[model samples]
Target: MQNRQQSEIVRDILTVCNGSGTTITNVMFHAYISHAQARGYLGELIDKGLIENDIFDSRQYRSTPKGLKYLAGLETMSELLAIETRRIAKSGANIC
Candidate 1:
């Protein structure tokens, strides 16, 4: 399996919780990260105001509007990079 970047993992987590709140376990599973990683990321995201713990259920987390914006930006960057990669391939240019 190819390793994903931290930003990609963050995006995955945000996507998972964007519509409805989800537990940390769901975030870990969906982001393909370990428990420790999930905890760390969740803490950081919460601190950054990108995610918030549900008031009714602290175990559940949901993405904030800022997080959605961040996710959108990351998705756009990924798409642009993929397009550049395809263009380079067509031109027979090495990316690395």
Candidate 2:
């Protein structure tokens, strides 16, 4: 897989936790990251208050309200970028 940006990885993590609380292994597998990488990013997400360590299940991670908002914003920006990219590609072809 292509190397994704930090924001992209974080977005994926948020998505992974969106439906339910998940273990580090689930996040790592779903996000396609190694254990070391998962630890680092998960820690960062928790630090950023984007994810919360579930008290009832210490091993699980859940997305915070802020994380859900971030995910929504990221999806919006990606959609906008895709639209702009398609428009530019079409215009460039016309110029040729």
Candidate 3:
């Protein structure tokens, strides 16, 4: 894959939560992001109402419905991109 986009990173973060809750450390490791990057994205996600701090577990985070919706959209886009990529590769067409 090419350089990861912020949306992709956010989607990864949301997916990692699994509705149970997850920590910044978990997201950083799973998403292959640095702590600082995780922190920044976490804050942004919280502000956007896509993620929220766990009430019972202050250190953990849970995904909101909006975050799940966004994650689903990203998955769809990724699948479409993969299909296009395979079609181009089969046809020997340049993506550039």
| lDDT computed for candidate 3 | 0.81
Cα lDDT, model 1, residue 54: 96
Model 1, span 1-96: residue lDDT tens: 456667878888898989779999999888888999999999999999999999999999999999999989987897777633322455787543
Could you tell which candidate, 1 or 3, scores higher by lDDT? 1
Clashing pairs in 3: none
Once fitted onto the true fold, the runs of candidate 3 whose alpha carbons sit more than 4 angstroms away are 83-96
TM-score list, all predictions = 0.82, 0.82, 0.79
lDDT of each: 0.85, 0.82, 0.81
In angstroms, the error of model 1 at 32 is 0.7
By summed lDDT, which 10 consecutive residues of candidate 3 come out lowest?
81-90
Q: Is candidate 1 or candidate 2 better by TM-score?
A: 1
Better of 2 and 3 by lDDT: 2
Off by over 4 Å in 1: 83-96
Residue 72 of model 2, lDDT score: 97
lDDT tens per residue, model 3, 2-76: 566676677778889757999989999877789999999999999999899999888999899988898899778
Candidate 2 weakest lDDT stretch, 10 residues? 81-90
Q: Which candidate tops TM-score?
A: 1
